[model samples]
Target chain A: MISVRGVHKSFGGVHAVRGVTFEVGKGQVVGLLGANGAGKTTTIRMITGFLPPDTGSVAVAGHDTLRHSLAARAAVGYLPESAPAYSEMSVDGFLSFRGTLYGMRRRDRRNATERVLGLCDLHEVRRRRVGHLSKGFRQRVGLAAAMLHDPPVLILDEPSNGLDPKQIGQARRLIRELARDRTVLVSSHILPEVEQTCDRVIIMARGQIRVDADPKELLGSLREASPYIVEARGDAAESVLRAVPGVERVEVTSRPALDFDGTAWHTFRITAAAGAIDLREPIAATCAARGILIRELRREAPGLERVFLSLIEADEEGLPSPPGRGRWPADGRDGGGSPGGAAPQSHGAAA
Target chain B: MIPAASAIAVREYRSLFRVPVGWIVIALYLFLTGVVFVSSALIPGEPASLRYVFGISGWLLLPVMPAVSMRLFAEEFRSGTAEPLMTSPVSDASIVAGKYLGACLFLLTMLAPTLIYAVILAAVSDPAPDPGPILAGYLSLVLLGMLYLAVGTLVSSLTANQTLAFLGTFLFLLIALLLTGDMAARLPGNIGAILIRLGLSTRMEDFARGVIDTAHVVFFLSVSAWFLLLAFVAVESRRWR
Candidate 1:
């Protein structure tokens, strides 16, 4: 539904968007993931025809944004960052005004306003002045205005930024429901929200796309390239498991059931081979020979959080690392940490 | 272009009615003009005229005009509401024209009640007030306000801070007003004439005296158009930056 070719935009000496290019297919939910000031907003402005790219072009629904801006803009609904709206206008008034700007008929404008108010759960507050609403309610009002015309494509920037957890969940669900019929491109710094809501994610850093892949594919790649997590039950389990071939790290867990039963039992999680090996079978066989009962022996899959951290690390290294893969081990052995190497890590994980 | 212009005009008109600032400007202008007309005509015991009324109001708009136009684009830029308007299908020229018309309509309303002073002056005076100067005076007031509104709008487009926009535009008008009298004379004769022609008070003096020179009218119209065009260019430049 949309194509952007080598789009570059600069603000004076600062390059905000640098030769970024991507496509959004019809009825697809794509998340434009990036940290603050990653040129996502700049790229969106170009695509929506709000600003022409300094170089190259952006096309929406087969219409050139620079040459046929009116047609392109008419087919796209944009929710700008911060959900800006006229404070003096009521929720209904703003939506209707926006609808009229999009050239909707009077009857259809009213109908669409009502429809979108319901879609964004803004019916009860339709008559309220926009300035009087809370952040979450204001966000819904912004969303309703964008959706009022029922445009084929919806571009939202940080749609859930100020919302509470419950409201964020609701907004995410609403965005997903919207994608069932229309193309949606949402930008956000929140990684898990994108994983749950978007079918594919375009990770951006600096002024370029770092990785663009399906959520499942990213997760699969990470599992194949990161440490595997394993758990088993045995005497001296921590030491024994740590000694197992390919085991890089091991930590102990308390069994509350055993404590309640007046007996001591321990659980250990092991990090092992990251690639071309299934440590579960070897660990199971080792445990069986050692008379250690294998209570749980499974490979832990990497979630979006891990993949996100890994990609950020890759960006810091000044290279585009494969998606779903963690930083490569320096010793050429998977799951082994090199204490001397300057491995990039998140503060959250390091703490 | 006309439909978009009409839409912006109606919306601005409604906004004026809804906001108290519009009423305040009108009421203040009327009360102040009433006092000036009474002092200049009723107290002097001379043939009554609206010449002094136009003189005071034209000078009064130096501050008042900026107050009204300061929010024209500044509020939109601050609130980020300019995005939807800029991103819409309407051209920059249409937006500038619509806003100019809106401010002009407000100027009309402010000028409308001053006619009451004209009527009251005629009723109590020995000689009826001259309608010729009154018409010319009102025209000058409208055009002067237009010129000021355009400058205020261009200043407003340069910043998202309303107070800064107001101060910046007000200072600019103050300088322009200063150039009309003793301050402008100090300059060389040719430069002084240019400044005098560009001066709000000097251009308005021709209309206030009931002499509607085409050159003066065109000057005011061009001044208004030039600032408005600058405002349009300023808004368009932001997208590239």
Candidate 2:
């Protein structure tokens, strides 16, 4: 339902989006995943007809955004960044005004207003002024306003931006439900939110599309040196973990500040050799045969963050990243190094 | 187009009441106009005409209308609501028209309460006030208000800073009024004659004396349209950059 061909946009000297190209088919839930300033919002704005590309064209539902902007805009609903809505107006009043702008009849405006109010779970605050609501509620109010017209295409920029955790869950459910019959394109800097909600993820970095694939395909491409995160109650666990056949390196990540049970538990991050087979079983069998207690032994699952990070790292440091994996770090640097050992927490992420 | 413009107009008009700035502007304008009515026209043997109030009210609009219009686009852009609005399926003209008309309607409301001056004079004066000049005086103020607001709307569209929009509009109107009202009297015949015809304060005289001049009316409306057109172009320019 949306096609962008060689789109380039610049603001004075800063090139916001450069030579970006992608197409989103009908009924697909796609996420433009990126860090801040990755040109996701710029791309969405061009598609919504709020902006015109400097060198290329964006078409929505077969309507060129530059040549037939009104029709292109008419087919899509957009929620801009920060979820801006007129704070002076009530939710019901704002949604009705939105309907009127779309040329809906009085009865149709009322019905649509009611429908979106319910869809976004905003009926309780429908009569209150938008400025009087909390940030999460106001964000939902913006979402409600965008989908008010029931357009076939929905383009939301950071839709979960200001919502609380519960509200984010509700919004994810709503976006999934809405994408059942429409082409939905959402952008976010949150990695798991994209992984959890999007059917296909297009990871962008520095105004370029670095990676685009399904979540599973991204995970399946992790053939680099996979790490085994081990937590046990012993000092010898490190050497025991390193003694496994597939083990190449083992580093102690953390030790407890105080031990209530006489001995401190140490956390070990074990990097497996390339093309290792079922290291979890081998590590567990080795630890069990040696009489070293194994409190936890699990292989790290590759996440979109890993793929996303490596790609962005390649962009920054001229290194080869793996969606097709062969090489590890060229200098034997730490795989998950983020300066203070706060990195590798995503190993705790539920993939 | 009509529906979209009217919808935006109605929203703008009502929005002026929702914030403290809108109420403060209306209050200040009516208070100033009331003081003028009481001090000059309400006196016992003052010809029972609305000349004094209407004359100063035109000047009052120089400051007053900009306050009403400065937020028309600037506030939207500041709060980021312009994204949803400009991206909607409405044309640029309707958005500009709606905002301008909304401010005009506000000026009309602020002036409406002053109509009691006519009834007051009619009750007390031996000969009631001349209805023609009274009606003409109002027409003059309305046109002047519309013209000033168009200028304010154009200034508001150029930037997202309300204070800058307000100051830019006030200074521009002040310069225009000064050139046509003061400088026109000092210059030589040809330029002076042209300035006199173009001067809003001078043209208001024809209205106060109960003469409806078409050239003066057209000048006010056309210049207003020209400014609004500039505003529409300014609004459309946002898409390119």
Candidate 3:
């Protein structure tokens, strides 16, 4: 439903987005992730036809954003980052105004306004001025305005910004409901929100797409490559762990962290073999059975944060963007960090 | 195009009444025109006509119309509401036309009460005021309003600051309508002849005398159109920047 090709945007001398290319298919809810000044909002703005890309093009619902901006804009329902609205207008008044911009008839406009008001849970505050509402309510009103026309494509930048925890959960559910038949592209700084709500996450760094893959793919890849940290005092720990079923290899990472009561306390990193069960339970049981002093055994949970940081760090070091499955440990070894040398280096054609 | 422009126009017009600034500008304008009405139009032994009222109102609009138009685009930019507006399917021309029409509606509202002064003039005078000059005077007022509001609209589109828009417009009007009239008399030749004709105040004099000169009417409309066209270009240029 949306295609951005070779899009480059510059503000004065700063290149906000450079040679960025991505596509969001119909019915796909894609989350855009990035840190401050990472070009997420800039990219969203270009796609919404609010600003023309300095080079290249953005097309929405088969209409070019620059060439047929009106048609392109008509296909898109955009919620800008801060969700701005006229403070003087009532909630219903604002949505009705949006209806006019979309060219809906009077009756249709009233119905759409009523529908969005109910959907956003804005019935009680419908008659209140928008400026008089709380920040979270204002944000919902902005979302309602975007949905008022019932456009096929939605490009919301930071939709969950000011909501409370419960409201954020409600917004997540609302977004999922809205994306049932529509294309959605959301950009936000909140990682877990994106991880839970988006099917696919695209991570951008320094004006480029560094990682683009399914959320599960990224997490699974990182989990397969990550190693667990074990801090304990045990006899023959390395050979003992390697002999355990489902254990791939074990290595002593550092000298004794402490010498407490005449015994050295050391740290080891344990790696599990490919398709092996989680090693935490098995490792602990084995240590207990053998009378080894077990202090800590914890696997690095490979969530979206690990993958996001890895791609960004790799980007800083001048590595190309991924077919990020390349970051997985194809050799079945643990790399154990977001920017492990092997993960980004192996990145090429592997998906 | 018509629907979108008209919708925006309605919003803009009604919004003027929604906030205190809108009512404040309207009241201030009526107050200034009322003062002009009492001091100039109601004097005994003077000709019972709106000629003086129309004349001073031209100068009155020098600052008043800018106040009406200063917020037209500047406030949208200031509050960041321009995002939803500019991103909508509406064209830049429609946006400009809508705002222009809205401000014109406001100008009409401000002028509506002044008509009562005319009724009083006709009733109180032994020789009723000639309706010809009264109608023509109003025609001049309307023409001058079109040009003045158009200037305000054009200036407002260029900046995000309301004060700058108002000051810029006030300065431009001062030079084009007032100073040019005085300058045209001293400077001789084709340049002087052109300045006199182009002087907005000079043209108002013909209309106040109950002469609806087609040249003056065309001049007011064409200049206003020219200003509005520039405003359209200014608005469209934002995306590129």
Candidate 4:
């Protein structure tokens, strides 16, 4: 329902979003993951026709954002960052005003306002001034305003920013419910929230897309080359562990002089390659051939947090990112060694 | 577009009355106009007339009209609500027109209570007052308010700071009033005549004399429309930046 192509936007000398391109299809809840000032909000603004792209184009439901902004905007329900609303207005009043702006009929506006109020669980506070409502209620009111017109595309920036755990959970459920039929592009710095709510994730840093993939596949790929913790007691245990076939790097994490059975126990953390098979059997065979007595051995599943941090760290260091499984470059350009070597496609379908 | 603009205007109008500032503006305006009327227009021996009342209203409305229009767009920009309003399906022209109309309506409310002065004049006069000059005087008041409100609205769109908007609008109106009244007479021949013709005081004097010239009406409307259009352009420029 949204197509953004080769978009480049700069504010003064700051290149906020640079040559970014991505598409969100019908009924897909795509998470835009980035740190602060990573161009997520700028991209969302360009797509929603709030800010025009400097050198690219954005289309919503086939209407060009710049050329047919009114039609494009009519199809979008945008919840800007911090969920700003007319704080002086009541929740119901805000929804009704939004509905009217979307050109809803009187009866339809009332009905839609009622529906969103119920959906966002804002019925009890519908009559309260929005400024007087709690932060969670204010967020729900923003969500309700966005849903009031029932637009096909919803662009939400940091929908769960200040919510407590329970409110965040409620927000996640509300997004999931809304995503049943609508196209959603939500930007957030919170990794787990995005993981729980989005089907596919697009990670951006330095105003560029670093990785884009299905969350499960992205996490699974990290799991394949996961780290291992090994502790052994023997002569040259570190050397033996380093010589193992699948072990790419081994570091002596702890080498305390503990006299266990007249031998010093040592611990090492091992990192395996992407194609590493089960290192357990190979390590075991190698350790037994030597007189190394195994103390502790376990593999650590790479969490999303690790993957996110690694990607950001690589981006900060100017290293070629480990291409996310089924990833695509944000821009069609092949610079920065993005490993999804295939030619960039115009739109991404539901994975 | 008209419906959308009207919807915005209605919302703005409702919000104005919902807050005490709106009531305060109306009360302050009526109280000032009352003081002016009693001090200047209530001549014991003369015929009941509102000539002095309408004459001073143009200057009186200068400061009051800015207060009414200062928050039209500045508050929206400050509170970050302008994002949603702009992202909505309404056109820039519609938003400007809506806000201008809303402020004009509030100014109208401020002027509505001043009608009591006319009633008192009509009731107490030995000769029932000629409704022609009175009607013309009220028309002049409304037009002057419209023009000042439009100028204030334009200033409001220029910045997110309401104080700046108020001061900017106040200075502009004050200069306009000064140029047309006192300064115009000090200038040389053609310049003096031109300045006098452009000043609101000249047109208001004609209205007080019961001369309803279409030229003056057109001038007020065109100037108001000019400022409203400028406000629209100022607002739409945000998208480019």
Candidate 5:
């Protein structure tokens, strides 16, 4: 359990984190999403008791970070960004030393080190110097050092930065497994990894919280507010579907059926208000009234990419979008408006 | 505080002996002290007393202490490990004291072999050597090392570059050492007497003459405390940044 209230941090003339506030409940895996220099690491540092906030307070498991830093730090297991480690120490020795610093007894320190080595998949290289290991292994060793104390909360800054895809997947699974009984706050720039690993998402931009919601409900609510695409195939399906009320737009396509002796099948795509009475019901009723049998009808919902871009653009343009319904530009694409249209991918995400 | 201090002390001591530079420092210190000891005590017409030998060996600390304390906090800052250590449960005083003790211990190891100088003088003397002066001289040498180490620790905390730490601390100690002796007499009236009395050479005079003055003891202790406090404050100021 962690509570951060109106935390602000600045260096020289630059404001790194500005009045950010959020709470993470026990056993919750929260992903801190942000662009480069978006204050994610700064926020993590404040929570971990490394850098005290310039203007607010952080409490970890009821211990005030400023007033009772030792207790607060005792409750936190932090893996710093870049996996910075003691170069001269071997994997086992480093973990042991970190364990001692965390106040573990020698015997318990060794036991915890052994357990974390297995959990992070670092047993094979336990005897090797940390500087001699590969980047992925070094990251794993960093993870082990953090987990060695068995702290109730884990704050990891860019934990999956340099790992390969498989290693990232392994780390994701490990975080999820660890989150079963502890709080996890993982910061990352990679959106999908957060989507795959975190239970809740906190998107930050320009030193402020842009959006915070369950990844599923957030996207679903956005989809309900945006345009819904419907495809139908039947005799005069295009006109019949377009005739229904609330059908704001329509596109028609024709394809010849190979088994039907070259008889062309008509398909219509209808775009309408999200909850306009499931346009299929009325479209089917109208088709039946016209004696045109319907073949297929399916609704295509907008993806999360649309919702995220809409929110970010709204944030950048200084526009006030709807509270829960994220605003998006019509042509869903990545930020900066690149031409080839390589946008973030989205799939079925429900709360 | 003791637990944290001991934890840091053990770590520092281990790193010193485990690395190549640690041995190199000890070897280099012994060689330099040997050269100075022979030039002052073993020369053909030089005095048989090892007083000059101990005195010059005290000057040997001018350059040696920077090597020992340059990496105290500076290397930690540069390597980024300072984050975890500073964020840990340890206090600033404990960290500074631990590092100072580590440096002192290294200086002691270097000073250990030089005791043979006193032994040689005792063996080849007209009357049995007065072990009092020998003991007092070694005590002053240790105090001088502590004073330089405190300054070096403070300098290390001021910058992350070890080279800068070395140069900064070296210059600071040199200035502090100069202000207390012949260098001070050239200045004004009462100030010159006070500076001469406080200078390393003047304070160490009683010890070289086989008399330990409480004033000199208090002076070295005060100097050690002042610099160590500065080092602690320097380290704590990092919390603001």
Candidate 6:
């Protein structure tokens, strides 16, 4: 339903979106994920024909955004980032006006307004001025306006930004419902919301797409590449743990027992080699033979947060990796002290 | 395309009456025009007519027209409603034409109540006022309002600040109104004569004298169309940035 090709946009001397390309199919809900200044909004503006891209083109349902803007815009239902509306107008008045702009006839406009009002659950406050409503209600008003024309493509930028939990849930459900027959592209900085709502995820960083994959597949591949964690306590536990087979490196987490109090415990996190055999039993057996007490031993399952952070970190470091192996390069694998590397280790217990 | 423009025109016209500023501008205009009519035009010995009333209202529109047109595009930009508006299927020319028409309609409403004064003049005069001059005078007022509103609409499209739009439009109309006659008289050769002939106020005098020259009508319409075109260009320039 939407095709963007090598779209590049710059403001003044700064490039906001550079050579970004992606396609969204019909009935697909794609989540655009990025931190601040990632060009998500810029890319969206280009697609919506609100801002023209400097170089490449954006087409919606075969209508070029720049060449045939009216037809392309007619196909798009855009909800801008802040969901701005005419504050002096009532909800019904605003919707009716939108319908008129879309060239709907009077009877059709009235029916569409009533349909959207009920669909967005805005019937109760339909008569109230939009400025007098709360943020959630105002968001619904924007959604209602966007849906008023029944456009085939919906582009919403951060639709769940300031809403409460319940409202966010409602927005997610509404988006899901809208995506049942239309193409929906939703951009958000909230990772979990995207994970829960999108069928496919596209991660952007510094005006480029860093990673694009299915949410489950991305997480699953990252989990398969994750390292193992083994904590042991006793005299010389670090050396014993490091001596085991298939152990790549062992980094001790804390200072060893001092003053001979016999109460101090030492922990070591282990990173095993690719295709290495199960090191958990081997490490346990070694610890037992060495009179070391095993405190904890487990393999960490990488979650979406870790995958996202790793992709961003890799992008920032200018080391673009193949989709799955980008998390930790072989040579740069220090035991877990790297920035964003500690998240997976700490969250390992929960997984 | 006409339907789209008309839809926007209808909305703009309805919104004019929905707000207090529209009513306030109309009331203030009628009050000032009524005062000017009673003090200057309604004399005991002089012949009863709407000559002074139409002229004074034309001058009054120098300020009143901007008040009505200042918010035409400035408010939309300031409130961020321009995104929804521009993203819609309507073309820039249609939007500009619709808004200009709406402002012109409001100006007509402001001029409508002054007709009562014309009625009173015809009723009380011993020799009834000539209907020809009265019709011409009203036509001149409509043309003058259209030109002013078009200029104001162009200025509004240039800025997001309503105050700036108002002041800019006021200064522009002031220069257009003040510069042509006095400054044109001082210039040398045919340029001076042509400039004086182009003076808006000078052209308006013929209409009050009940002479509807095609040249004057063409001038008013061409100027209004020029400003509306400029507004359309100003709006379409957003796509480049």
Worst 10 residues of 1 chain A by lDDT: A342-351
Tens-digit lDDT track of model 2 for A183-281: 999988788888889988877766766566666545554634457888876777778888889887889888553467777778888887666776889
What TM-score does structure 4 among the candidates reach? 0.91
Model 1 chain B worst lDDT window (10 residues): B9-18
TM-scores of the candidates are 0.87, 0.90, 0.88, 0.91, 0.82, 0.87
Give the per-residue lDDT of model 1 (tens digit) for A204-271. 66677655667766566555555544445445556667767877677775552354545445666666
- Best-fitting candidate, measured by DockQ? 2
State residue A173's C-alpha deviation in candidate 2, in Å: 1.4
lDDT of 6 by residue, A124-219 (tens): 999998889998888889988989999999988888866889889988999999999999999887888888999888777777765556776666
In model 1, which runs have C-alpha deviations exceeding 4 angstroms?
A: A164-170, A224-235, A243-269, A281-285, A291-301, A317-351, B16-20
Q: Is candidate 1 or candidate 5 better by TM-score?
A: 1
Q: Give the per-residue Cα lDDT of candidate 6 at A260.
A: 61
Q: How accurate locally, in lDDT, is each candidate? A: 0.76, 0.84, 0.83, 0.83, 0.77, 0.82
Q: Per-residue CA lDDT of candidate 5, range A14-114, in tens?
A: 99888777889999999887777767888888887888899988999999888998899889888888777877788998898787777788899889988
Model-by-model DockQ, in order: 0.58, 0.84, 0.76, 0.72, 0.39, 0.63
**What's the TM-score, to 2 decimals, of chain B in model 6?**
0.96
- For model 2 the local lDDT of residue A44 reads 90
DockQ of 2: 0.84
What is candidate 2's lDDT per residue for B105-165, written digit by digit as tens?
A: 9889888888888788788886788899999999998999999999999999999999999
| Tens-place lDDT digits, model 6, residues B199-223 | 8877788999998999999999998
Look at candidate 4 and tell me the lDDT of residue A191.
Answer: 83
Q: List the residue pairs that clash in candidate 6.
A: none
Clashing pairs in 3: A310-A338
Query: How is the predicted docking of candidate 1 categorized under the CAPRI scheme?
Result: medium
Q: Give a tens-digit lDDT track for model 3, residues A1-351.
A: 999888889999999987787788989999998888888888898999989999888999999999999999999999998899999899988898889899999999999998999889999999999999999999999999999999999988899989999999999999999999999999988889999999888877777666676887677666766788888775566666777788777888888755556677778888777667778888888877876777788987777877777666655665543324356422112232343233221211121
Per-prediction fnat values? 0.47, 0.90, 0.81, 0.69, 0.40, 0.66
